[model samples]
Target: MSTLLPISAKTPAGRPRGDGAETAQGLTPAQMARRMAGLEGLVWLDSSRPGEGALSMLTALPCEVLAGRMDTDWQRVEEELEAGQKAGLAGGLFGWAGFDGRFVLGVFPHALVYDHDRRCWFDSGGLAARIPAVAAAAAGSVPRLDFSPQVRREDFLSQVRRAQELIAAGDIYQVNLAHSWQAAWPRGADALSAYQRLRRVSPAPHAAFLDLAGVTVLSASPELFLKMSGREIMTRPIKGTRPRFPGDPARDAASLSALLASEKERAELLMITDLERNDLGRVCEYGSVRVDGLWEVESFAQVFHLVSTVGGLLRPEVSHAAAFRACFPGGSITGAPKKRAMEIIQELEAAPRGLYTGAVGYFGFDGESRWSIAIRTAVREGERVTFHAGSGIVADSVPELEWEETLHKAAGLLAAWSLPR
Candidate 1:
C-alpha cells in the first residue's frame, strides 16, 4: 500500500502552493496501496474524550504532520449548502523545518508525499512534501487497539444506569452512550475501498482515516469536529438519532419525525449544544457563540438524525488546537452530562470504541482546517473485518429502538461488506 504513494522531496524549494478541496479519487484498491510507498507520518484516531491526551501526544511526535480542518468560512458553507454544492474548500495543516507552527494544503481530496523519482509513496528516510488523503493506512494496517470484548452488556448498562441515577441527582439533562472496537492492522487491507463501499449505504459530510506514527487511525466518521478558514470556526454535532427501516420510506419518515419531536431527543441535542458553546467560548471572541441551526433532521440511507450547527469566531491569536480542545470527542457522539455519560457508556459497553467515535482529520500548518468524528467504520486485518454501530440511550430510549439504531449506524459498513441486502 505504501509503494504507490511515493513521497518525493522537491529538489528545488519554492513557496508551497495551496490547492482547493479534492474529491476522493475513484481508484482501485491496488492503486491506493501503490500510493503509500515511502512516507513518514503519525496518525491519531481517538474518541472525543478531552482528557485522553492522544491529540496532544500526536502533535508532539517527531515527524512532519498534516491535519484536516474545516473551521473556516462558515458563511461560505451556507451559500454552498443553499446552492446544492457537492463540496467546499478545505486545506491541510503541516509543521515542517523551522516553520514549526504553520502547514499548507490546497483542498486536495487526499494528500501524501511520494518518492520524487517513482512518484510512489515514500516510507523510508527522505525529505518529501506533505499531503493529506481523506483515506489512508499502509496496505492493510489499522489503528492499534487494546480491546475488551468479553465485557458483559448487562454489566455495562448497569454502569450507565448508575450514571443516569447520578444525572438525575444533578442538573444534567442528557448523555450519549457508546461501545468501541480495537485491533491493529499492519499493511493489511484497503481502507478507502471500505469507505467508498460504506458510503454507498451511509454517506456522511465528514469522514477520514490517518496513518501516522506506528499506528493507523481508522474512521468512517459521521460527525464534524472543528473547521476553520480564516477567523470562522464551525462545528455540526449530531445529537439525536433514529434507526432505518428496511421496508418503507413513509414508515422511516414517521420514525424520524418522532425522533425530531421526542423530548429525549431534544434533551440530548441541547446537552451537546451547551457543551459546544462552552468549547467555542474558550477561544471564540466573547458573544461569538451562536446556534446557527438546531434540531435539523437529516436522513441517511439507514436512519434519520437531529443535527445542529454551532459556531464562533476564533480570537485573533487563538490556535486551532485550542478550538478543538474546547470540544474534543464532539458532544453529539458522546452522551450528555458529558463526563458522567462517558463514564457510564464506557462502563456499560462491552467493546472499546477505538477509532469508532474518535475524530479523524487533518489540521492546517499553513492556515486553518477541520476534523471529522470517526463512526460507521470497519477495521480489517488479515482475513477478519470488524465494524460497529451504536446510538444514544437516554431515559426514554427504547431498548428495541436503541438496538435498531445500532443497526442503522452499522448499515453503511454492512453494505460495504457486501452482505446480502
Candidate 2:
C-alpha cells in the first residue's frame, strides 16, 4: 500500500532551514510519481521542460471530489471552487474537463510542489520522508503495444472529403476532425512507466500524468488552452504542424521555412486566433482583449507548430464559471465558427471524444489557474488504453494529406507506445 500523509502547516523535519524548501537530493519527479503510483486522485501537472515557472506538482488523497456530466456542471464547479477558496485548503484543485463538458475535479489538502525558479521542493505535508526509499526501485519494462485505429484509413479520408465538401458549400470554413486508437493494456506495464517513457521521448511544456480512482491519463501536450492569473486571462493556440528532422539540419531548416511561408497554415492560425479573441471578449473588459503573439513557430521533440497567443483582462463581474463557459472547448481544437464546426464533427465522427481536445490543468485556491489543450494524450481505463489524434480540415485540404497530418501529430504518442509509423 502507498503512504498518504497530510500536509503539515509547520515545517517538517529534514526540510532545509530559512524557508523550508529542500533541494531535490534523491527523487526526480518521475521517481516521486512512481512512489505514489496507483494512489487514487493522484495528479501531477508535470512541466517536463524545466525553467517554465512551476517545475511539477504532485498531490493525492483528495479532500473533495467534484464531478459533473452536463453543461450545467460548470456552474457547480465554479461554485465549489469558490467555496474551497473560502474553506482555506492548503493546496489547490486539479483535474480535467472533457470535450463534451463532462469533468472530474479534485481539491487536495496535501501536496508536493517543485518550483523550477527556486530549484527546490515545497512539501505541503509529510510525504517526503517516504519518497526516497521507493525512488531506487527499478521500473518494469514496457511491452509492445498493439494499437488498432478505431477509424479505418479509407473511412477517415472519406470523412475528410466530406468536411471539405461542407467548407466548399459554406456550411463551415474549417473543422477539426479526429480519430482514436486503442490497445489492450500490457500486463506488466504501469501508467507511471509509460508516462516516464513518453516524457523522455517527447518532453513538453504542458505535460501531465494523472491517476484517478479508475482512470489514468498520460499527456505530452504542448498547447496551452487557458491561463487565469488574477483578473488577467490568456490562451495560446497551435494550428500548423511540420515534422522535425534532427539528423538533417538543412531539411529541418527547410521545414521551418516552409511552415512559415505556407498561406494555408497562416490562414488556419488566423481563423482560430480570431475565434479565441471572440471567446475571450465575451467575459473580458471591453477593448482589453488583444492578440499578444501571432504566427510564432514553437519547436517540440517530434514537430514544429505555429502558435498564437491571445489575452484579455476579465470583467470585474465575471465569475470563474462564466469565464470557463465562454471558452470551455478551445477554438483551436473546435475550428472556426465553433458551434457549427462541432456539430459537423459530431455528425461525422464515430465515437465520443471523452477527454481528447479537452482542458487538463488546475484551478488554484489562490484564484489562479492554467490548463493545456488535451492533445498528445492517452487514457487508461481498466484493461484498455486509448488515444486520439486530429487535424484541422479546410477547403483546400487534401484528404490524403490531412490523414497524414494526423499521423504526424501522433508520432510522439505512437513512439511512446513503441509502435511504428
Work out the TM-score per prediction: 0.64, 0.91
- Please tell me which predicted candidate would have the highest lDDT against the true structure: 2
* Displacement of the residue 360 alpha carbon in candidate 1, Å: 1.1
lDDT of 1 by residue, 228-268 (tens): 76678999888777776759878876887788788887877
Reference-based lDDT, each prediction: 0.50, 0.82
Give the Cα-based TM-score of candidate 2 against the true structure: 0.91
Task: Give the runs in model 1 whose Cα sits over 4 Å from its true position.
Answer: 1-160, 181-189, 379-387, 418-421
Task: Please give the distance, in angstroms, between residue 94's alpha carbon in candidate 1 and its true position after superposition.
Answer: 7.4
Deviation from truth (RMSD, Å), model 1 = 11.5
Q: What value of lDDT does candidate 1 attain over all alpha carbons?
A: 0.50
Q: Which 10 residues in a row give candidate 1 its minimum summed lDDT?
A: 96-105
What lDDT score is found at residue 173 in candidate 2? 90
